[model samples]
Target: MRLGAHISTAGGAYRAFARAREATCDSFLIFTKSNRQWAAKPFTDDDIAFYKDAVAEHADLHPVSVHAAYLINVASPDAALWEKSYLALREEVERAGALGVDFITFHPGSYMTSSEQEGLDAVTRAMRRLLDETADTAPNTVVCLETMAGQGTNLGGRFEHLAYVLANAGPSNRLGVCFDTCHVFAAGYDIRTPEAYAATMMEFDRVVGLDRIRCFHFNDSKHGLGEGKDRHDHIGRGQIGLSGFANFVNDPRWADFAAHLETPPTEDGEDGTTIDMNQVNLAALRGLLASSSA
Candidate 1:
């Protein structure tokens, strides 16, 4: 698997490539715009050129995925919010296309007060609309819907829910999945053991058809199984522990996907958060994989 982390894109889109390289990442994730804010400064032509040049320079980095903003809610019951969400997502997709990224990952969004079926329909419609809008520009870029934590009315926590969206989507292949280990564990998939991990993947294969899994958010949860909590703890320091990561890292099926660390930084230093504990966690995971195979 290509190991990486979600690096900051504060300076410019291209700068994230350098940041990821500094983190010793073979792949990386970035947000095209500020995740928390609805409006963002428009990207200049220079930004696009620089981003393309950076990607060309880092040709060895197989896949660079862009994470969508947190404010989007395609499944929102509120019509105004839903429209804004769709527009924002369309803009992000366009931006990713300009940067030459192949995948954009986003949470499937919450249902709010709407029924689950209605929410699913709304999400599907929004996605179809976005695809239609960007059909001419970003034909190669796939939008990856992420599995949620099942907190309150949030959707896509279940394998069937994701499968449903994929099946109903107009261009099925245009849609994919970014599976979060913490959310799955919180949603009650036992992946801490080899046997359980296998079982969980088997279930995913049966329901969502593992082929749809394009990216992974490699976060260990702070909560226990079936807790439905979305708290993310640093690797091994959380409830999932090292064994769980070992099981995942050793899995041959995820070899081609980008497994990214969304965990917090380790320590502070003069050079902007000098120490990153995620590197240690990734090294430990690699060591575990090597030892297990040996």
Candidate 2:
């Protein structure tokens, strides 16, 4: 699999490429804009040129993706906020397309006080509208709906939620799924053992057609199964231990797909030492591949 992490676009958008390249990654993800902010400065022609040039410089960065802002809520019951989210996501996709990003991940949003069916319908409608707005350039990009931790009334926690979105969306191949291991485990799909992992995957195949899944967010859950928490921990040291990661890393079906680490970033502490946790987590994942090799 092509493994990487979410790199910061702090200094400039193009810097994310350099960061990922320095990490010796095969792929990487970025937030096109501040993930907590609702508005963003438009991407200039220079921005696009710089990003393209960086990608050309780093031939190994196969697929650079963007994660949508946390504030977007297309599934909200509030009409004004829902429309705001639809436009926000539409803008995000436009920005990603401009940057030559082929993949973008977004949470399917929460229902708030609405019923589950209401939330599903809202997401379906918003998706249709968003797709319609970007139909011209969407062929170059795949919008991935991320699996959630099922906290509160969040959508896409269940495979059924994903199925509903796919079934209701416009007939477009650009729509896909991004499976986060931590969220999947926290949402009650067991992956800590061989039989359990196989069973959980089989269920996904049956309900969501594993074909729709195109990427992975490789995080171990800090909470236990069925906890519905969204905590992420470094690989092996969490509730979903190395056994879980080994089962996933060894799965031949996802060999060509992109998997990225969303674990906490490395912080510089007192001494001259640095703590890049992604390296540790990524090493653990790679070790699983060798140890589990047949």
Candidate 3:
């Protein structure tokens, strides 16, 4: 399992590699710039060199993926916001490629005012255009659409939404999905039992093809099935529980997939003083594997 957390890129973007190494992460996610803001100073040549060197030094942290800015809303019914979001996403993809990151994932965005169909089409079109514009620039980095908790009118709560986006993008360009366990549960795909987990995965495979799923955001939900809430809890401590994760963790099919934690970090990195929640959660996941295989 490629296990890690969303580590901070506070001092410099390249520092995230060292932090991943410190956390004992095989892979991790980081925001190349600010998560809340759109404007960034740009990644200088030195910055790229340092990042590449750090990544090379930590061979285990090979596929450090970028999480796109939080403010992007390409599904916005407002034309101005949509355009701005499209441009920002394009910039994000380009930057991630330049840094030689493995993947860049983004929220599928909300379709609040417009009809869901229109919103899906809008997002799909934007993806196609972004891929076209960054064809040569960002060819290596895969653009992944993340599964979302069904908060308000977010587009990716259902598996179909992601399938539609991929269908429109076609097979040639770089495209994929990031399946979030908590979001699927909040959207009503139960995985607490073996039978239920199999059923849910079968449905996903039918609609989107499991091969298209490149990464897993391993989290537990604070809410129950179909709750539409977006709260993430510690692994095994939430409603989804241990069995939900065990089934996925031990599956032979996804043996090589990355399972990343978005759980809250230990305050001030104090262990004994403050718990390393990531280590705790990762241990919980590791414990599940034996039972699942048995």
Candidate 4:
């Protein structure tokens, strides 16, 4: 896997490349605008140029992705909120395309006050419309549906949910999945052992073809298996121990895939030194690779 982190774009989107390089990232993820708000200042032509130039400068970074704003809920049953989210999501796709980003991932979103089928149907409609609208403009960019922890009415806890969206939304290449380890584990899919990992992956493949998975969110769950919570901890310090991660790190199938760390930024130690957690997590993941002699 190409190990990395979700580097912040606090200043300009171009700055994320330097931050990713500092963290020793092989690739990275960034939000095109403020994640908390729906409104964004339009990217000027110079802004897009600078961002593209930075990406070329860091040629080693493969498949740098964008995470959609948190407020987007394409699955919302409410008309006004749904329209707002769909519009925001559409803007996200356009921005990604304008910057030549390949993947833009977001949660499938909460059903809230509706049946699961209704929520999923809403997501399907929004995805279809989004893809159709951006077909000519953003042909190369794929919108990825992230796996959620099944908290509250949030969709995408099950593989079937993802499969449903993909089946309904596209026969288009623009739709895909972003698998999150912490979310999947919390949703009751086990990967704690090699056998468990194999089984879980097999189930996912059966329900939703492995080919649909385009990116990953590498996190460890603070909650246990089947806990249905969304808290994330450090790579091996959480409920998903090193062994579980080793299974993913050493997998040849995903050797070229980008997995971004969404874990905490810094950790305080006994000596009062602040540790760079991304470096620590990357090292831990890299260490999982089998020795040549083994």
> What TM-score, over all chains together, does every model reach?
0.95, 0.96, 0.95, 0.97
Q: What are the per-residue Cα lDDT tens digits for candidate 2 across 1-294?
A: 888888899978899887887776688889989999999999888888998899888877878889999999989999999989999999999998888788999999999999999999999998888788887755588899999999999998899999999889977788989999999999999999999999999999999999999899999888999899999988897999999988887889988888999987685758978887767777778888955456
Worst 10 residues of 4 by lDDT: 285-294
Candidate 3 — worst ten consecutive residues by lDDT sum?
267-276
Give the per-residue lDDT of model 3 (tens digit) for 1-294.
788888899888888888777776778988888989989778889988988888778877856788999999988888999999999999999899999888899998988789999899889889889888988898899999998887888999999999998998667448999899999999989999999999999999999998888888999999998898889999998999999998898788877888788988785543448777877887788888865455
For TM-score, the strongest prediction is: 4
RMSD to the true structure for each prediction, in A, is: 2.2, 1.6, 1.9, 1.2
TM-score of 1: 0.95
List runs of model 1 lying over 4 Å from the truth: 268-274, 291-294
Q: Compare candidates 1 and 2 on lDDT and give the better one.
A: 2
Q: Which wins on TM-score, candidate 1 or candidate 2?
A: 2
Question: In model 2, which regions exceed 4 Å deviation?
Answer: 267-272, 291-294
- The Cα error of candidate 2 at residue 240, in Å, is 0.6
Clashing pairs in 3: none
The models' CA-based lDDT, in order, is 0.86, 0.89, 0.87, 0.93
Spell out the clash pairs found in candidate 1: none
Instruction: Compute the lDDT for candidate 2.
Output: 0.89
